[model samples]
Target: MTNELPVISLFAGAGGLDCAVERCAEPPLVHDGSGSPLRVRVATDYDGTALQTLARNFPHTKTILEDIRTVSTSDLLKVAGLSKGEPTLVVGGPPCTPFSKSGFWIEEKRNSQDPNASLLDEYVRVVSEAQPEAFVLENVQGLTYRTHQEQLRRLITGLRESGYSVEYKVLLAAEYGVPQLRRRVFVVGRRDGKPFHFPPITHSGESERDREYDPSKLPFVGVKEVFDGLPATPENGEIADGTFGELAAEVPPGQNYLWHTDRYGGRPVFKWRSRYWTFLLRLDPDRPSTTVQAQPGPWVGPFHWENVPNADGEMRARRLRVPELKRIMTFPDEFEFIGDRREVQRQIGNAVPVELGKVVIRALMEQMGYLDPLGDGARPEQVQETLLF
Candidate 1:
């Protein structure tokens, strides 16, 4: 059973979490005493584009491109080659739009009865029916807001009644090695009544620094660190030649268009602080990026603080390329995304950072007594090429 623990991945967008699981099963993360690595028995998603990306990256795994609501546990088990009572692991991050802070504030759609909001129930249904040895559920932190606390309680209670011990926490992705400040909630459940320990933070910032300063806490990764080596490009591949591009040039690093002034030919079209922070937001180069949106507007930001020398030797601003965005999201350089530009942005933005996934799953493995103490000493670079085609 060294590398055969069956895994069923639901809503597997671009297979980010799946990639992390695969990495953990094989390398430095999983050494001599670790239990068998998880094998992707089946991966399911309703989005055709996402499934295409998953297939491109994980050609060996069986993928189901169908709505979860229409799929039965028996069918999933059949595909996974697992018996009804066999040990298995189910993992998913259902679309969080329904319970997202942005979605919750959208007056008309705030009702919990909205179809999208009910997908959590679908996730629970699948876990109850599958009766897996363990399961991992991930979602946006807004789900734990006081308004949605009842839903959270019901979810935990339902899982407990179903015979799995459940524990949860809101985890910061930056702490887990992702180069952004993304907070997500994770719920882990096990059939054997074992409690899951959340992984300790491996990276910290000024806030954490005020507490006990541990020598092991690495400094937070900055935007500059990730982008320093790549060649510079403008809004559409070269220097920005449009009005919006010109405005971006005037905005300084770390500041948004709000800093623009009439003296510099800039106009205040929008009221101050009225727009979302992403509007004209530029990266600081010294700090981790703000959250990457799944769908950024034509002028929305967390835009790169990229600049290239002009004829006079002055630097000018430009938008981030698709590849740069992927790097910021912590996706492997070799991971191939399949879709039009907009769709690709959505897929990447919606994905769980692979680094964060590795930390969380490693914690789960340890808590379940599946970890071996011996070191494999194999790094990610050594194994990534073999895992992705």
Candidate 2:
């Protein structure tokens, strides 16, 4: 029996979790002859631009464009073609701006006061009402910070009241082969109260300190490798042309504005620790990209490594294009973004990397007996996806 799991997605920006969970739903073994074990039934979000993109990518899912606060749990189930308690899985990350680690990194104000903070409750509310076999909650790692401990306590208590045995951890996206260093927290719950096994790190750093990981693990994917072959328009020469823009090309790959800092062994063009870490960040071909920003300033970057010439033939470093960002974020090559440039980038920045979600969701399914192991003895998670377009 397929015994399909009906998946409902909330705060479903750009369908990153949906993409990964979709991969998990597909039966891994060919001869098993079972249909997909999980199905995404509905994806709901407040942003029309984001829902527009989600609908295009996941047309199989019913899209509801409404604020989660106003969207009733019964309505959500009905839209998913499900009755209460009939769903297999529900997944989403409420908007994380309230808990994001920006200037408010340690601010006590990063609490339930912000209007966005209420969205977390909305996630728990839906899961409580739907009573799925399991639910996954994604958010910025900052939620686990000491200042927000009260909220975290309430969240755990809220889910446990509904009989969920919850497990959570801060996961590194690069460790799962996404070509970027993104840190996020995932909270998973099982209605059966069985212990849930989070995905293991199948990829690791090559450094000696990283030897603690299983040696057979693959190296963390590099940005250059992920961008091996993609189209670009250096002729248009979207050069980093502000005051520091001209210096972007000179800073060398993988180094940021700190490249010119005295402490970093370069000429002290700027004071040590004077700028934000991302002020002039450039990609290192051999390293995974730093976390991309939702609203990067003109000079903020993990800028492209290959300096390209403008129409005048002057070679200069340029900001990353949409195509490269998608690869780094593990969005498939053909997936289309439905908004203007800034809005599109914001969706990508806010998403859980598709590969990272796939690793976690697949492991969860396998451990829970929803997925079968390969006859050849290799688990589905063992087979890494290139995620190439």
Candidate 3:
């Protein structure tokens, strides 16, 4: 009567994708009408800070702070209480800088040290050894760029050779109720020879799709829809300080507090001057947030809230608080984040949006016949109707 599904995670940065997968696998759903909860027993990451954070949050899972590339297949399997070729699921994302647009944005040796950069090879190595029933790969949207086309093709070929039927697509975080407008590439593969199917899109945007998506059936998700009704934090006392300044400060309604306080107090917003201000301008409350950068330095936004303009023509706001940023990334209020403000921001920015992962995993499970929509109380007609929109 146990409904527990075994999962082994690699490159498990701050447990974002694992959190989503764990959430989707928990009771009220993943329960096989039994009370025993689904569980993720093993996770690994090379970063000490990330490992510590993962340990603090997911106390149930065993975490290893070691480079996944060096971890043998036997080492990983022993940690998971299983041997190679046992039926289980593997989920992970290689460190993405080498495969990212910003990474190739410049041609330099520094950008090439992408440790997780060789991570895809490690992923394939693990898949071949573990022989899991299914696997999921997460990465930056930049992976699909022209520069990485060949590397991607090779990864696909490797998975097929390992006996997996694979499919991939670029998924936007906003489409799954994350307030931020982040996009990532996902590769889902199964060992059963069934082609992986992408989850239906539940949100849309102004950008024209290659094929027109049904607006009525698959309604567009918006910024307001996700973060709306969430209470705003008042600009006041500092909660945590960072290189930018105090975690909290008071500025006009729509002005860039980061710009005003970045070693140049009382200065005009970024719109007025341009030096040292490379981050996106204040977050547009009316629209979804632009891509959240991995590192938000001085002159970069901790970002303003709501983008409200003041009488002086400067926008009033402060850097994004840790709570708000988590909300933007679609982390539930109860999902506690650990660490300093900067590290927290990095983790949140780097995580897979939980809602997006939920749909994708559900679709994959359906293709495997391991899950039935009707069993979950979702009627076939209703599923089709939801898909149309």
Candidate 4:
């Protein structure tokens, strides 16, 4: 172990994983880990906004905003001021849409090489070539589906064949402190025989460990807890222009779209019907959120507070906003995205939650002997900046 835990980031969406790793074990609280401060020396991604965000947040690091398939192992470490055999960490996830639980059903040949689905192989290629001491792969829970289960099985087997000890599991974001109920599949591998451990869930409301733990136990962060401090003003300010015509004209507070129309005396009005009524009805706020889809169409939307009904006397189902989405993904408020609204949403929705990554990384670091359990003093400084394009 050295003074800096060098890192190589792949498919680094909006640098959420990088930011989270940087903020893993900072001041005030100390972490019991085995690795040095995780340093993201090299971050590579195809998306311009994502790469720019990574660069903006980690100016000292080398960012390659190009197709990762063409990126060679030497090129990655060379830019990071390192060489082969140096202890380094590689982390990233291939686009998990095909394996996502909410993705379109692929009833055909699962082996078909869709450009997006085959990207997982590229990740494995980099791991083999770079030969990092350890690596982390994150993805949507869909990777565990029965249809695409073989792909995941192959990925784990491939890592082990490459001479690494690998571990993986599906994790709930709320269990790690994020307000949103997002779940993801995480995989870790170490070239050395030492086994890697996943972080334990520390914040379940019903988990007996909540009361059994000491006062220093981590607190459960909820939706209200995350958004409580934000301003009450709407981002669009009630759609004042009424661009959506009558639908927008009488749009109730917190309501985004209407599925039905009503006409009064010489006036046409619109009505809102909750989409996916059954799913919305079962949203147990006391527990974690259901999976957040890439496109939160009418049927599945983020629910408002239970008792806090909107102006129409109906609880409006609105998609989670960008900042809220980022928070839900466990990205620090300081980290920014560099892209259009749609791209931003896609990145956040498609990303690995930061807090969850931190816990995983912390566990690995501890195994490598990098963290100080007892507060030893100065830790890395986390900067506050908008990294999104």
Q: Pick the candidate with the highest TM-score.
A: 2
Ranking by lDDT: 2, 1, 3, 4
Report per-prediction Cα RMSD to one decimal: 6.2, 5.8, 6.8, 8.5
Cα misplacement distance, residue 100 of candidate 1 (Å): 1.7
**TM-score for model 1?**
0.85
Clash number by candidate, in order: 4, 0, 12, 18
lDDT of 4 by residue, 140-162 (tens): 77778776677878888888887
Better of 2 and 4 by lDDT: 2
TM-scores of all models?
Answer: 0.85, 0.88, 0.78, 0.75
Model 3 C-alpha lDDT per residue in residues 261-287, reported as the tens digit of each score: 445455444344443333434655655
Better of 1 and 3 by TM-score: 1
Error of 4 at 184 (Å): 1.2
Candidate 2 residue pairs in clash (backbone atoms < 3 Å) = none
- Compose the digit string of candidate 1's lDDT tens values, residues 185-295: 999999988788787788876322244445678877777887766665433443433457666776777778677643333566556667666777788887778788897
Once model 2 is optimally superposed onto the true structure by TM-score, how far is the C-alpha of residue 312 displaced, in angstroms?
Answer: 4.0
What lDDT score goes with residue 282 in model 1? Answer: 85
Against the reference, the lDDT scores of all candidates come to 0.74, 0.78, 0.65, 0.63
Better of 1 and 4 by lDDT: 1
